[model samples]
Target: MDFSFLPKYWAYFNYGVMVTIMISVCVVFFGTIIGILVALAKRSNIKILEWLVSLYVWIFRGTPMVVQIMIAFTWMQFSGLPTISFGVLDIDLTRVVPGIIIISLNSGAYISEIVRAGIEAVPKGQMEAAYSLGIKPINTMRYVILPQAIKNILPALGNEFITIIKDSSLLQTIGVMELWNGAQSVATATYIPVEPLLFAAFYYLMVTSAMSGLLKLLEGRMSNGGKA
Candidate 1:
């Protein structure tokens, strides 16, 4: 009831909000690329590459996400690893890098499955027809297979992005100042837990709902185009 504390500690909340959005966006973009690669390797004839992809996916997917974050963070800290300087901004890679890497790896494992399923759902005849027309394998996947497969996978990818948005909250364990971290800091400063947490929850709800709405609109367009 006493969210009077919100105005007092808005800066911390902003930090948390920014961290979550930045991390989730970077993770989703890079994760999808990594996922596509893994999916391709899974379906490729190269035995050793397929095996390596399997191992990476298995390790990332099977293990707890928090464990990955901690391991990456701890390794970087203990190794005295250097932070990245981007001219105007310096990134503490020990914090942001590990958080992004862990989340991206975890997402890549799951997204790989989504992508593979999408690739499989495309009709085999499509690939055969492209081949008969003398399309290269790369061109077939690029121009023929992927566009159709994306329609089936878009919703699932949106959901994964939502999941990443929420899951990044756990990065507080590795000293990433994400959403939950904002709540915790406000709670500690104000000695009022529920209101700060509720505020954080409101931000999460707003972001996820907006993303869901956009995905629905995209799906509608996709469906309508198919009809036309």
Candidate 2:
């Protein structure tokens, strides 16, 4: 209940917040790219590609993310990833890399289904019209299908981003120095575990709430024909 430790350890919590946002952003970016590709492949009408993508989605979705993170961490440790410097920031690939990869892959599996649903929701006539005009299949998809499908997919993508923000806390288990991990560090240093965790909960609530509000606004604009 004593939060006198805040002044001493607030910086650590702030750093944790930064790491959480960084990881979630990276996961969402990479996951969306992977999801779009996988969704397109599943819709390709190619049996082998469809089967392979289905198996991938099945495995990632069926298994626990924590287990995946642990396995990825151990594998990356064995193989080793190089640390890279971004200006003054030294990114420890050994820690962040595994978490990013695992979480992005996990998110991609789920997002693929959402993307597929969105793509399918697009009118078949739109695709046929593009093809009748001598457009290549890829071009038809790129110019005609995806743009329309994106409107349907945007809300789900927002929800996925929210999910990733919370799930990034799991990276703390592998010493990724995210929000939950920062709270743990503060707890150990201050011997006031509950307060630090409460701080993390508050921070998380603020972030998710802000994101949810933005998403609702965007959805409203889209629903209203992009009117402000």
Candidate 3:
């Protein structure tokens, strides 16, 4: 097989790789924030808030992400409403923005439970002691709870990051032109399917493997200090 095409198409592949990374990073950032809020809501004292969060998590986590993406894209098309708009400034949001939002919202559902489990894994005694010390609930959570919870959550969160990195490939269905899309484009253009696609697979493996290694190092460091 001629391997020379790689150098010739390096720029396209690189651009696609960057787009893939951007989508994964955006998903991780926004997904984590949304997950935290949902987890908090799930743990809320208010019954209605807890129910609402539970429903949100149930729907997203129960459904397939591809279906959600299809629904989102179709809704955007049918609504003919921009995913984001500044009415005063009259600026339109790009397709990538909505794509990121859709992916993050879907990912956030699963992350919520991960976060909730992490938060709950903290000892009850710590919270009781904080309360006995006259610490406000919010302050107690901010200072004592979340910091301890994070150690428990970090490994799972890292796994989620890796999952998002692979799942971002699904965005190609919406014309995102990410790594998978690049491989497909090259395959169609050159009439050679296997090589380019294999290359894309190799790239994905490289990225996720590196991430797993980093996460292992972090886990070791955190564990060295004792269990959270």
Error of 3 at 61 (Å): 0.9
Error of 3 at 16 (Å): 1.1
Off by over 4 Å in 3: 77-93, 225-228
Q: For candidate 1, give the lDDT of residue 212.
A: 97
Global lDDT scores for all candidate models? 0.90, 0.91, 0.84
- lDDT, candidate 1, at 81: 57
lDDT of 3 by residue, 26-120 (tens): 89999999999999888889999999989888898889888888777776755454644323222133446667888899889989989999999
Q: Distance from true position, residue 188, model 3, in Å?
A: 0.6
Deviating ranges (above 4 Å) for candidate 2: 82-90, 224-228
| CA displacement after TM-score superposition, residue 155 of candidate 3 (Å) | 0.9
Q: Model 3, residue 97: what's the lDDT?
A: 62
Q: For residues 1-228, could you state the per-residue lDDT of candidate 2 as single tens digits?
A: 799988988888888888888889999999999999999999888999999999999999999999999999998886667877655345678989999999999999999999999999999999999999999999999999998898999999999999999999999888888889989999998888698999899999999999999999988888788443
**lDDT (tens digit, per residue) of candidate 1 on 73-102:** 887776665776544334566798878988
lDDT of 1: 0.90
| Global local distance difference test of model 3 | 0.84
lDDT of 1 at 110: 97
